[model samples]
Target: MGVAKKSIEEIVQAIGGKENINKASHCVTRLRFSLKDESVVDTETLEEVDLVKGSFSANGQYQVIIGQGTVDKAYKVLLEVTGLQESSKAEVKDEANEKLNPFQKLVKLLGDIFIPILPAIVTAGLLLGLNNILIGEGVFYDGKSVIDVHTQWKGFSEIVNLIANTAFTFLPGLIGWSAVKRFGGSPLLGIVLGLMLIHPNLMNANEALQQDVLPQWDLFGLGVNQIGYQGQVLPVLFAAWLLAFLEKWLRKIVPDSIQLLVVAPVALLVTGFAAFIFIGPVMLTVGTAVTDGVMAIFGNLGGAAGFIYAGINSLLVVTGMHHPFIALDLQLIAAVGMTYLWPVRVMSNIAQGSAALAMMFVTKKKTLKGTALTSSISAFLGVTEPAMFGINIRFKFPFVFAMIGAAFAGMIVAMNNVEGTIGIGGLPAFLNISPNFWSVYFLATVMAIVIPFILTLVYAKVKHKDL
Candidate 1:
């Protein structure tokens, strides 16, 4: 997967050289550059660079499309040659915010905050799936949970559950750490600050809501309610960013003599109190409203929502906005024990693959046919970027058919009331499928694959002969 040094140098030269770049970053499938001047970029020459599948300008960044299989190799080379500091997607969001509208910026912020902590949540989700298999009724224990038949394994199961529950249980701390890290503050201090929000001494927010037992605290003549921040998103993100902003400000103004001791403690106390009295309640309410609103749209509209969502899902992927939905899907799973969003993702990926496969079969040029074959194979294996920028989107018409395939299949799944279990939204979803929905899921997936393949293949056949 190592890209040639010459190719890396060529890519760097083609993007108006290192001097024209403000910052450099990488997502799962693209090397993103924030250039000082967009006009200096030679798009034609850059696309000709070896190992560079494609390039495009979006959200104020010049993004060179790199395949997932070789992105790391190429990203490292770009970093070395450009001497650009390594940065996370969150950091890049800030660098590229000039091109985003206010709403897009807000969504980017949420995605940036959550993306850093996703590995933990995703690992926990997989563990939850494993736990469900053992303890869920009629799953793997022959009509009884595994622990019921084998009492000796109860402690082991408890340990596993504990491991599985850690991320959700202490979500605030992870969010805090990630937010501060994004803000260029010490992640450790932010984590400590976050843990304080969910301290055991405070009344559990969710439990209090469920049982109607919120204990009120009086502070500064205000009746403040105690609410633990576990399993909460907005509170921690706000608090962490607040802490970082305050700490940075204080460090600038505070005398150097007493800075270290005074800066951290004062920042923590002020930020923590502000979070409790202001940000926590406000963010909680906002999060609830947004979640409820989205749920309502999906609930009332059903198939229409699914059609729109699945249809545009690939476009989101291409623009790198899809990362935001990772948290949204997890939130849905938390709320309803499953998600409709993820199953459609599987369909979208299959549709993309189908389009790529169709292009491979119909292209007259042997070179393009080989490229399409590689991308299609990767797409089928649950990596769609190759099929996307590398084949379908590049061909133009195939991408359209892919979206159509996803939309119709998504509508079908929604009409059948298909419910997807909690898991990664790709192939691993099969392991987490809800009972009785497997056949519906499979048939819908087949529809996604077949429709795009046939439509795109027909179009390509006529176009290739003309070519």
Candidate 2:
């Protein structure tokens, strides 16, 4: 219990104490501290605090990257020990506006855009896995494939699909809603806009691209393609931002007497035209280019790309900026039938779990050990933030070891050419794996876990006199 408190106090003191602090806030895995002055920050000492995985300055704030679950505890203590009032994320953002570089602002924007729809995405992923599990030749507890052996269960399966499809099929609408709300527009309006993008009359974006379904509308005087953004991500997010801008401007220009009637209508018409004409087509190109680049790296560079991907995947998880890549994953699956990223994701998640578990055995501190055990389980279950920020990350060696573990796992997976056909990753995501590649994936998972655990355990024993 006191371990977290002790850690929080050390964190506060090492960051130049209460007087240097201007504001403090936190996200899923980082304690965001806005210091009155950055020069006073003791980065060296902050690193030495065993509870802190690492510290870095970003977005005009001195962000101490901590993991989930335990972060909440540390945050409360951060306020209490510093004797400072807790601050809202918005307040912290406003004060630290000067601190945010373009990259940091982009990161913050991504967090805003994705956080709202993350649950839906994760749920959709799990549902995808569940659907795969229930229908496959390797279906848990049965030897039957859904199509061949479980034909009678088609009715039940359709119901399952209905439940599953709700999120993924209408993903654009969901993203639209989330993005619109994030941009300070009416959430309902955003959702309505989103659903409108997928109206039955319009041609689906994927279908139009594939030419399997013909376009319903071609612009009268221009050659621009017109299609609905069904599963397209960037188009909708960009659309939401554009919608907010238009809506706000309309509110300013339109009179109150007829504002309700004309404002939404004009905003949607102009925004929709812009979206279908330019934003949708342009971002779709960007998405394609990114997908090609990621695939080329993995395809051409092999193990090197794997090593890089696996290592950075953990860091991306740190900042909650992994959402953008979800679009890439979808594209990869569409292009190559399997995404190389999922295998690395599995390695990153499992290795963190392994390191946290290793910490449990080697650390003499009871609270950290207990937290390690709990967080390790959480990591294994596909939530890495707790194990990462709390245990593996705090003990710097564990995080490094986990990175090493991910690198080696990536190498093995790449060499084996492991891939997943679905938009899922982490532990049970292997459940979504096709039958032929299971053995290779199993070995990669083992490598990811065992290597990091042993390395971190050895480092702990060599360094800790208490152990």
Candidate 3:
């Protein structure tokens, strides 16, 4: 028999529905629920519903993984059935209650693990990318200037660079903390391991190896390379997780009398060496492979590639898969000195932003109108989360039209050979275009904005009646 199509009311009842749900939200792939209490709902029963992908309780909230398009549908049903609205109140609840939803739990966990460290990353990336641009443009002599690095006017640049460089410098530490949290270990120990990797002596040794100078350094007959381990990913994170797992097992075997000293030393030594020899290389290789594949595909496609790339890229951003691709693109730009992805990315962001703006003008609901307004502004600032999650995903057809509009603009830009030299993409990426092609770049940027804006307005006008 076909699975029963549970009405919103029945599904709500199964999941401990109330006259009004206190808060509701979603993650990349889950419809998260924070109800008054867990005892009222039958989570297992809710999972049996046809529309529900899967349901589970984690942290403190009930999470229903509803896939991509389904999350918006489920969110709509939730809002309609429960007569509840999303707002700031939903985000300020007790940690215990917040954890009930797996999406919320993951967000909280990732936040706790990464938020303290993100400033450094953002700063480093901005500085490094900007530095490359300045140096390329001959704005600074030999990529260093008293004014560029130390002056008061350069405070913004210095702060950003410091953050980026520091983050990269202590990357292992960041990974260690995240890995420890992921593996349920003592996060501090992971950070300690990260610090150990970036020690000065180790960095000096790595420099020697790069010069093919064999240094007289051996521990247990294994040659040690002094490599600077800042700004690196993969290895430290893998090592931290590996150490956490080993520590968990060792704790069971070692007697309490000497467990602390013996188990910790063994776990750290084994994991640290493993990271240097195996995990780091493996991660680097994977990142390289993914980047190479994307580049190869993009290179082979030529002028027409932008259409498919822009359309799919917009969809990925809306679905939260854009980050991985963006990460790879940035790495490629850093390594190869050019990028093809930014033209498409910039167009897509503006397209979505324009769509949100259009939605603001047409939507009668004050709540949605406000959300659209905020989201559109956020997108202009290169923060698309508000636009994608708050407006585009909910309004549906507007996003589709936006993608179509972006693809059209992107194709024209690509055909004109519009490219960005900088690592950062989005609206700001226009500044990174080569001056020789400024005329073409300006046209591309205008097209990116206008095409999407016009299409979005037309789509919203036509679709408004249906909605």
Report, for every candidate in turn, its global Cα lDDT versus the true structure.
0.78, 0.76, 0.63
Better of 2 and 3 by TM-score: 2
Question: Over the stretch 326-408, how does candidate 3's per-residue lDDT look in tens digits?
Answer: 34444455335456777666777777787888878887867667767877876766666566655676557767777877787
Kindly report which residue pairs in candidate 2 clash with one another. 53-393, 60-99, 67-389, 68-385
Tell me, by TM-score, which candidate is best: 2
Candidate 2: where are CA atoms >4 Å away? Answer: 1-12, 25-32, 42-86, 138-147, 212-220, 319-321, 330-338, 415-417, 421-426, 463-467
Instruction: Report the C-alpha lDDT of model 1 over 1-467, residue by residue, as the tens digit.
Output: 56888898898888888898888888887888888888888877887776777777766677888777688888888888878888876576567888778777766777677767877877776776666656666655556887788789788888887998888778778878988988877888889988998999987665665765577788978988888766667778778888999899999999999998899999899998899899988977776676677678777887898899889999898776887786666556544556677777777888998898888778776767777888877777667877887777766899999999999988877766676544554445555556457677788888888999999988877766652
Name the candidate that leads on lDDT: 1
Clashing pairs in 1: none
Q: For model 1, give the RMSD to the true fold.
A: 4.0
lDDT of 2 by residue, 82-120 (tens): 888989888887898767778777777776776677677
**Positional deviation of 356 in candidate 2, in angstroms?**
2.1
Which runs in model 1 stand beyond 4 Å of their true positions? 1-31, 36-50, 66-104, 138-158, 211-213, 334-337, 364-370, 416-422
By lDDT, the better pick of 1 and 2 is 1
